[model samples]
Target: MPRAVNARATVTLLAVCWCVVPPRLAGDFNPYGINSAYWNSPSVNAAYRAMGVGTARVLLDWALAEPADGGYDWSAWDTALVHCSSHGFAVSLAVCGVPAWAIRVPGRELSYAPEAFAEFVCAALNRARTLAPGIVQSFEWHEEPTHAWADGIPPLHGTEQRDPSQYFVAILTTTYRAVKQAFPEVTVVMDGIRGAFHHVDDLYQLGCGPYFDAINIHQYQPHAPGCDDPSGMHLFHFPTLLTYLRFMANRWGDDKPVWVTQYSWTTSGWGWGDIGEDRKAAYMEYVTDVSRRLGFVHRVFPELGVSSSTAGAGSAAVVYDDGNYVPGPASLSVVTTAYLRLKVCAQAYPVWTGIPEPVPLLPAASRACAVVNGGFESGAAGWSGAFSVDASTRFTGAFSARVEGDGGYVESARFAVEGGRLYEVKARVKVDAPAPSSAAVWMELFYSSAPGHLGYVMPENYYGVVDTRQYPGGWRRVCWPYFSAPGAYEAFLKFSLQGEGTFRLDDVTVRP
Candidate 1:
C-alpha cells in the first residue's frame, strides 16, 4: 500500500505564495530536515546533522508517553527531542494518539476530547522545554490529522471516518489554545495534509483559519503524469495548486508561511511508488532546489532520516537497519565509521546550487519504467498477440500468461526508454511442451521522429529473437539484457512460444 496517501500526480506548477514567511534557510544553504522515529540513535542524528538537515519532526504519541491518564513516561520523547535539540535542529512537534483509557477508534487516529489532550500537550512541552533547555518546537495538534494512518503508521488509538471537519477543528482549536497558553512563541502549523487538495477546503470551512500560525504541505510526486522526472506533471497540477493557494488567501483572509513537512519517493520498488536509489537521490537534490525556488516553502523535510521495521518507515529512510545507523541508497557510499555521507556529498554539483539556489533549470526526477500488467494479474489486459491469463499457475501473484502453438505470443504495451542505457527483461516461464518446445524473447526499438523508423539493434540481436530452453523443475528464470543503440525512443517486451505445448509466463519485469 502507498505509505503516504497523496493527490493524483498532475503537472506541477508552483509559484511563490505572497504571504509566506521570509525563509531563514540561507545560512547553511541547506533547507532540508529529517523526519523519522529513530532519532534515539546518536549516530543517526549525527549523520543527519552532517548531511545539513537542520530541522526535525517529532511524532509524539500521547499513549506511549502517558499510558495511564496522569502518569507520564519521558524516555522515548526525551531521547528524540534532546537528540535534535542538542544537534541544533528546530523541531516540529505533533502529538499522536490517545491512550486506551480514552475512547478511541481501533488503530485509527480519531476524534476524542475532554480538553485533556490539550492539557497533556502543554504538560509534555513544559517538561520537554526544561529537559532540553532552549529547545525550539513548532506545535501541531496531531500528526496527520487529515488522514487516518496515511503515513502508513497507525496510532495506538484514534479517526473520524465521517465528516471530520468540525471534530478536527474542535480538537485543533482546543489544542492550539492550550499550547499557546503554555508557550506563546511556538508556531502552530496547520494541515501538512496528505491528499491535501481534498481536505484543505473542509478544514477552512470549519473555521480552522485563525487557529494556525503556518501551513504545512505533505505532497509527494505521483507516478501518473510523471514520477520519472519533475517536469512531466507540472502542466496539469499548476492550475489546481495555484488556484487553491489563491483560494487560501482569498478565503482565509491572508496567506500563511508554508512548510513542506514531507516530500520524497519511497525506495520500496514493490509497487509503482518506489523509485531507484540513484534517481531517488536526484529527487532529493531536485526537491531541495524546489524548496529554495518557492518562496512559501520554508523547508522541505526529506523524511525518515533513518528507519527500521520497529519504528519509522523502512522503505524511504536515508539510513536504515535495526540498532545500526546504516547509510541507505541516497548516500554517496556506505562509508560506515569512515565518514558521514549523503546524496549531496556525491559527484560535484555546484555547491551553491541548493537551498538558497534558484530552482534548477533541469527536468525534475521521474521513473522510466513503463511495463503495464507485467504480472498478468490484470488478465493480460495491456498485452497483445495470442495469450490467456491462466488462473491455476503462478509464481508470486495471482495469474500467469499462457501461450500455445507456434503462432502464440504475449507482448507488453509499447513504452518509452532512453537511448544508450542498458535495459534488461526478466520473467519466470514454465514450459509443458514436447521436445521441440522453445521460447524466445523478442525486442524492438522505435524512434519518435517524423518517419519513426525502427532502430537497429547490434549485429547479433538484429533479428530481436533469442531462443531459450532452460526450464527448471517448475519454472525457468529467463533474463534478456538489451540495449537501445542510439535514437531509440520506445520499445516493446514480447515473449513467444515456438513449439506445440503451452508455456506459462509470470512476474515479468523490465529494468532500465
Candidate 2:
C-alpha cells in the first residue's frame, strides 16, 4: 500500500510537469546558413563554423565554370566542395556571372537562353554530385536576380527588353526542371528580387513557382538617415516580411519553403566607412534574435568585413590583411551568447505566433519616483529625482533637485514629448556617479520609446527615443527643452545610478 501511494505521487508529479511544459512543433526547419565566396578563404570557414553556421552558399560563376562555350572547369569548385564536405558543412551553389561568349550578340549580353543556361546548370550539378556525393545539395540560380537583371547597364538585349519577365521565367523554369530531374533530392530555391514583394510576383507570373523547392530573399538594411525605407520598418522585424511571404506561398498554392539567403544589419561605422563598436554589437544582437524568431531564415551571410581601406566601399566578415584574419567584435558576439540564444529559440519554436507579448509595466512607485532595479541597478549611481507629468505639462523649463550621497553628481533635467502631441515626458537624472568611496546623484529629463517603433504611423507612433547623461551631485536648477505633438503618449522618467552608495530624490513636477 505504501509503494502504491508512492507510485501514485510519481504519476501526479509527471502529469503536473507535462502540463507546465509547452508543446513543441514537429519538423522544424532552420535556415541559418552563411554566404561565403571563394575569396573568403579558409579562415572564413573557421569563422563561420565558430558562429555556428552549418551551411554556406557559394558563388558558382557561369563565366568561370565554363570559360569556353562547351568547355568546363570544375577544379576550383572541386577543392571548395571537398573542404566544405570534410568540415561537415552543406553548400548551396549560387549560379551567376554570365559568360561573355554565351551572349549571342557582339558587345551585347543575353539575360537568359533557356536551353543553354539549363544545360550549364545541369552539367554543373552532375559534376558536383559526382565530385562531392556526401555533401548536402542546394541550388539558387543567382543572387538577387531581379536587381541584377534590372540594374545591368547597356541592358542584356535591346528589343527583347520589352519584358525581361519572360526571359527570367524561361531561364528559371528550364534550369529548375533540368536540375530537379538530375538531383531529385536537392532543394532548388528561387533567389529573391532585391527591392520588394512585387518583384517576386514577376517571377511568379513566369510560372517559376512550381520548379523550385524554396524561395530565397536577401535583406541588407543599414542604420543611417535615408539608408532604408523612411518608415523604419525593417524586414528583419518579426512577422513583417515572413508574414508576407506566407501570403505569397498560400497564393501560389505551393508552400515549398522560404529561405532568407542573405540578410544583415550594418553598423553606422565600418563597412559603410564608420565602424561604431556599440552599434555593431547592438545590430548583431538584433539580427540574430530576429533570425531565431523567424524560423524560415535558413542562412545569413553578413557581407562580412568590407574593404576598411576603401572606407565605405564594403567590409568582409573577416578582414584579411598582413596574412592574419581579424574578425570584428560584432561577428564574435554573434557567435557567442546571442547566436546561441537564437538557435535555441528556433529549435524550441519553429513558427512564432507573433512578437512575444510586451512586458508588463512594473508596479507603480511613490509619486513619479519609481524604484529602478533589475537591469537598471548596474547604472544606479547616476540616479536623479523622478517626476510624474500629465497632458498639460511642458517640461522644457528649469528644474531643481537635491540628493543625499557621498560622491559628487551633476543634475541635468529635461522633458521631450513623445507619441501624441498631448503626451508629455518628465525625467530627472544624475550623471557620472563617482567611484567606490564616493556616491553621486542628480536628476536628468528625457523620454522613453520602444526600440523598433520610432518612425511609424498614428496608432503605432506612440514611442520616443531617450538619451541620458551622468553628472556630479549637487542641488542646482537646469533648464531643458520639452515639447509635444497633438496626440496621446505615455510619460516616463530616467535615472542613472553610478556607485555603491544610495541616494534619494524628492519634489518632482511637470507643468503645462
Candidate 3:
C-alpha cells in the first residue's frame, strides 16, 4: 500500500523548483538543482553549499504526521519548514510509513474505501498549501512501491493484489485536483517506482499516464551486463535502460520529461570499509558527465552512511555530514574543461555502437556446416568461427547442424554473425540420442553484426547433470526458435562430449 505527503516538505519542493529553473530555456538545456537527504548538521549543509546544491529532499513518516485515526500533528513540520525557508534551502518531501491505525485490517492489503482515501489526499494537500504557501512544487507519494513490502514487511492494511496504477490514479487524481485548486503553478512529480520499464506499460494501459507533470526513475544496478552505465556508476553495465525507455516513450507518445531521482555506485565494502578515494572521485566524475550529456533533470547521490575521501569530484553540489551544502570540485572542472558538452542534444543519441552484417553460413549457397576435428577424442575440439553480414541487416530464422563419426566428440562450438563492429553469438550442440542419459553437452554461439566489434556469445544447449540412459543412438536433429536482429547477424554451433562418441554436423540456415 502507498502513503500520503507531509505538508511542510511539499512546500519546500515547490520553493526549490522555483529557485533552480531559469526564466528561459537555453538551447534545450537547463539546470534544475542538486539535492541530498540525511544531512542534519551544519557540516552537511556547508558541503552541500560548496557543491552548489540548491535543494534538499527530506523523509516524512506518515505515522508521525497522524498518530491517531483522526488526530493530526504539524508541529515538527512547521519548524522544519520555517528553518528551511529562513536558510533559503528548498525541500523535496518523501512521504512513507503507513500508520498503525491504517493497518488494523487482517490481510496484507489495505482497503482505502475510495471516499476515505480521497479525503485524506485532499486534506494533506490543503494542509501543505496552508503551511508552505507557494513553496511546495512536487509530491512523491511513496518510496519504491515495488519493494515496499519485499523483505517480509507486512502491509499496514490486509494483503491484496494492489495494482500500482489504481493507487496512482486514485491518490494522484484526487491530490492533483486539490493541489491545483490551491496552487495552480506548482509542478507535481511522481514517486520513483522500482521497475519502471517492467511496470510502465501496465500503468499506461491502466490510464495512469496523464496525472503527473514528469516521470521519475531510480537506477541502483548500474553495472549489469547488457545495460548501459550512462552515469558511469557501474563498470560493466551499459545503460540498456535508456533503450527500454525509448521503446516506452514511442509507445506512450507522452513526451514527458525524465528525472533520475536516486543513483549511486556501491563499493565492495557496502559502506562498512574504505572504497579507495581515487575510485570514489572517478565514479562521481563519471556520473556527472553522463547526467549532463544525457539531459537528465537531476541526478541525486543519496548519503546513506557513506564516507568518501574524495568528496567533491562528480557532483554539481555536495551533501556533507553536517548538513551544509556546497559546490563540488568537479562542478568547477566541468565549467572549465567541458562546458560546451553541456548543451542538450536535439535528438536521441545511440548509446552503443551498431553491429555489422552477418556473413553467409554456406559458400554463397543455402546451407552448410564445417567440421573441426575427427575420430574419438576427449579434449581436442576448441576453435572459433564467424559469418559476415551487411550493415543494418535484420534476420529471423532457424539453423541446424550435426556431427557424425566413429567415437568422435565436440569440445565446444557456437553460432554467430558479424556486422560493422558488433557481433552476436549463440551456443550450439549435438546429441546422439533424443534424451542423452549418460553425459551432458556444452554449446555456444559467436557472431558480430558490425565491423571492428567483438562478438557476443549466447549459450544454446542447457547443461546439467543428467542420466544418459534415456538417449542412445546417432545423428539427432536439434532445432531452435528463430533468432532475429535489426542489423547483420549469423549463426554458430559448438559442442563437447564427456564420453567417446562419433558425430557429424550440418544444416544451417537463416530466414527473414
Candidate 4:
C-alpha cells in the first residue's frame, strides 16, 4: 500500500516557499538542490535558504554505517536528516559504497553479495522511518556505477562472481523491491551513471526499468568552453546533456524522470575538467535555468554548497571551506540571474537556444506564428505521411495525428518565411511504447525555394532526433529552434519514424 500523503510535510514545504521562492513561482516546482560527499559538515541551511533550494542530497555509505553484519551506526545520518528537516529541506539519501566485509572479492565492492545488500537497504530504510520519518523522501541506490571507480570498482564484479548485467540487475532489483515494500511513497532513484552510457544501456537491456521511480545521472562536462571536448566524451552544455539523457530513455522504452545528481565546473587543479572562476559562475547560472526549463527533469544538484579542505584544489564549492563560510562566485545570484534572463528572453533570437520557444535576434513588435494544420482537426489536410488522424489520443483539442510506418515520415505543409530569420517548432507527443524499442523517432526542418520538393535537401544539422522515450508516460512537450539561411524562403516540418513504433503528435507550432 502506498503511504498516505503527509499533511505536515506539505505544510512545511509551503512555509519554505514563503521564505525563499518568489510569490509567483512558488508552487510545486522546486528544482534547486545540493549533493554533498562529506560525511559530516557544518549547517548548509543558510546557503540552501538563500538559493530557494528545498531539496538536499546526502551520501549514505553502507560501509561507514555498518561495519559488522547487522551492526548499524545512524549517528551522522540522523544529524544530517534532522539538520535538513529543521531547515525545511526535503532529503534525498543516496545509498552507496558497500561495506568492506560485504565484498565477496577484496576489490569488488560494487558487486557485493545481493542478499547482504538487500538486507542493508531494508535495515537502513527502517531506521530512516524512525529517525527522519517524512523528511526522507527519495533514496538513490548508488553513485556512478559504470565507469571505473577509485578502487577499480565498476558496475560488474572484478572477478567471476558475476557476469555482464546480471550482477547489477540483482543488486538494483533487490534493493528496489526492499525499499518499495518498506516505504512505497518514498521515490526510488537508480544509481546515477557517470559518462558511461554504454553500461547504463546494458543495465536497461538487462531489464532494470520497472525497479526504480527515477533515473539518476551525473554530468561533469569538460572544463573546455562551449561544453565540448575534442575526445567526444564531454557533455559540455545543458542541451547536449538533455539530448543524451533523452536518447538513453528512448532506448529503454521507459519515460522515467531524470535527476542530475552531480554537475559543476571545477577550477584549475580542482580535480576534473578545469575552468576559470567567471566561467564557473556562468555555467552555474546556465545549468539552473536549464533545470527549470526542462520539464522532464525533477531535480538538479549542483555539486556542493560548502567547500572542504579535503577536496583540495579540485573542489567545486560555492562556499569556501574556510571556517567563516564565505560565499564564492558560484552562489544564489548565479541562479536568480539566470531565471531573470530567461523571463527577459522569453519573447526574443538567440532565444534560449535549447528549447523551441522562438528567441529572435531582435524583438519584433508582432511575432509571426506558422503551421497550417497543427491540431489535426483538418484530418491530414496539411500533413503528408503513411498516417491518419488519431482521435483516440489527443494532447489538446479534438484530435492528433498518428504515424505507424517504419521508415517514412509524416510531414507538415510548407509555410512561407523570410530568409535569415530564426524560428521554433514545438509539439506535444506521446507513444504507445515507453520508447522506440529499436530505432528512434526523429524530427527535421526542411527548407526549399522550389515547390513540390519531396526529397530532404536541408543541411544535416537541421535534423534533430527526438528522444520521446525519456518521458515517463505523459504528453511530452518538445521544442527545437533553428536559424534559416540567408537565401532560404520556405520551410516545412517532418516527423520521421526511424524505428517500428506508433507515435501520436498534436498541437504542432512553428513560430517566427
Using all chains and alpha carbons, the TM-scores for the candidates as numbered come to 0.55, 0.54, 0.51, 0.56
Better of 3 and 4 by lDDT: 4
TM-score of 2: 0.54
Which 10 successive residues of model 3 have the least lDDT summed?
10-19
Residue range 437-463, candidate 3, lDDT tens digits: 233343444444666543544322133
- Ordering by TM-score: 4, 1, 2, 3
Winner on lDDT between 2 and 4 is 4
Native-referenced Cα lDDT, model 3: 0.39
Q: Rate the local accuracy (lDDT) of all candidates.
A: 0.56, 0.45, 0.39, 0.58
Which runs of model 1 end up more than 4 angstroms from their true locations? 1-30, 104-109, 149-164, 222-230, 234-243, 308-314, 321-512
Task: Sort the predicted structures by lDDT, highest score first.
Answer: 4, 1, 2, 3
Model 3, stretches more than 4 Å misplaced?
1-40, 104-128, 150-166, 222-239, 271-274, 296-512
Model 3 alpha-carbon miss at residue 467, Å: 39
- Candidate 3: TM-score? 0.51
Q: Which segments of model 4 are wrong by more than 4 Å?
A: 1-27, 37-43, 149-164, 223-236, 270-274, 308-314, 323-512
Best by lDDT: 4
Question: Runs in model 2 with CA error above 4 Å?
Answer: 1-26, 39-43, 105-110, 148-164, 222-239, 265-275, 305-512
